[model samples]
Target: MAVVSVQQVSKIYGHRLSLVNALNNISFEIKSGEFVGIMGPSGAGKTTLLNMIATIDQPTHGRVLIKNQVVSRMREARLANFRRHELGFIFQDFNLLDSLTVRENILLPLALDKFSVAMIEQRLAQVSRVLGIGNLLARYPDEISIGQRQRVACGRAMITKPTLLLADEPTGSLDSKSATELLQYLTVINRQEKATILLVTHDAFTASYCRRILFIRDGQLFSEIIRNGNRQQFFNQIIDMQATIGGGGRYNAITPGH
Candidate 1:
């Protein structure tokens, strides 16, 4: 089943003389357990499209449906609840609260819903073990390395077991090694936990981790490439497509799984 259905969606800004169609009738569906990526040059509407799916932004035309519910039409209060409970997010900046310890940050979602104490602890252990942050639970975010911080961000996002995970440049702030490790962790989360992920990144190496990719250019769906072989081959394909479309993607010297 399709976990996300973006049907004939479009977003416009300003009006008349200054009208900007940030997204133009974009359409796609991400099925359950699929790992997908969106790649494009700056202002190619990658972030705009992601915002629509994330429910942080609305489409000026058409509708976005997640799990068969019309998100664009949802009332404010219901939308807030749905976004909190149904969506998981990992941003470029680790959005953890400094006052909260790693454990508190990871448990915030379940804690808000008033989950039983036993269940919350069970989820915390499971997520921390999977992300290899079992030892960092008591430590504050300030004490951890940048990589560990990102991992904690991952844990907090996964703690909810959200139906769909939206990641925007999650590895953008990390060094090469840390970026790779986080991607590996995301791969494990995608496979082991059967989580549906939609990642947005211009880096071909990062895009290669996805099973399929949607390349955007000039605020539209320029083209797409699916992984038919290994990560290296997919990386090459992403690079070639980016070149053809004049996408300004960096991290060129790096190779995936090398």
Candidate 2:
């Protein structure tokens, strides 16, 4: 079954006098256990689309369904509950609390839901082992390396075993080595845990990690490329596509405003 379904969704901003269509009739479905990427040039509405899927923003038209539940029309209270129970988010900056230990951070979501202490501990162990952060659970966020911190963040996101994981530029702040490490961890989790992920990134290197990529242009679905064999070939194809779409260059070249 599809874990996420976005149908004919559009997001508009500004008044009638100065209206902007950040997203224009976007539609897509991500099935279970699929790792997908949304790629685009700056101002192409990649993040806008991601926000709508995350339920952080609502579309001006059409519907967004997660597990067949129409989230676009959900009340605020129900939406908050749905977000807590069904969704996981990984941000580019590791949004960890300095005051909390790695273990505590990973258990925060369960605590909010009032899960039993024993249940939280079991999930903590499982997710930490999956992300290879089992050894760092006792450490504070400031004490761990950037790569380990990202792993801790991943652990927290997976502790809930969420239906869909939404990642926004998850590797944007890391060095090349650290970024590669985190991507490998993400791949492991996707394959082993059967987690469905939809990642938003402008970098070809990042998009290459996905099984399939959707390129957005001018707030519309432009094209899609699926990985057939090796990742190196997929990375090369992404680079070529970026070049064709005027999104080529170093990572800095494709910043928010380019």
Candidate 3:
């Protein structure tokens, strides 16, 4: 079954004066255990679309459904609770708390939900070992390298065993080598945990890691390409599509007012 469904969604800022359509008549579905990429040029509403799916923003019209539940119309308090338990987020900046130890950071979600100490410990053990951050659990965020920090962030997101994982420029802050490594780790998580993922990135190389991609332009889905055989070839195809769509250079992260 589809884990996420967006149907004829649109986002409008103002009624008439100074109006902005962040997304227009957008529709798509992501199946369970699928790794999908949303790619677009700057100002193409990739993040806005991601925000809708993440339950961080409600669309002006239409619906967003996760596991058959309507997310856009959910009350704020319930939505907040649902997001904490069901949806996991990985951001470009890692978003780890500076004051907390790595172990604390990874367990923040469970702690917020008041999971038992024993349960939290079990979750941390499972996720940390899978993400390869178990060794750095006692250290503070500042004490770790960028790659390790990103892995910690990934562990934090996955510790709750969320149904769907949302990554917004997850590899943006890392070097090329680190980015590749992190992407490989994400693939492992997707396969082993059977987690559905929606990745928002502007880099063709980043999107290549996904099983399929949705291309957006001017707030609408322009195209979609499924990976056929080799990932290296698919990466080149993504680049070619990006170039054709006027995305010249690599856009590692979204810049406001692009």
Of 1 and 2, the candidate ahead on TM-score is: 1
**What's the TM-score of every candidate structure?**
0.97, 0.95, 0.94
Q: Put down candidate 1 lDDT per residue, 8-126, tens digits, no spaces.
A: 99999997999999999988889999999999888899999999999999999989999999999899999989988899999899999999999999888776697888888898998
> Best candidate, TM-score-wise?
1
Which segments of candidate 1 are over 4 A away from where they belong? 248-253
Predicted candidate 3 versus true structure: per-residue lDDT over 31-80, tens digit per residue: 99999999988999999999999998899999999999999999999998
lDDT of every predicted structure (CA atoms): 0.91, 0.90, 0.89
The TM-score of candidate 1 is 0.97
Give candidate 2's total backbone clashes: 0
Query: Whole-model lDDT for model 2 versus the true structure?
Result: 0.90
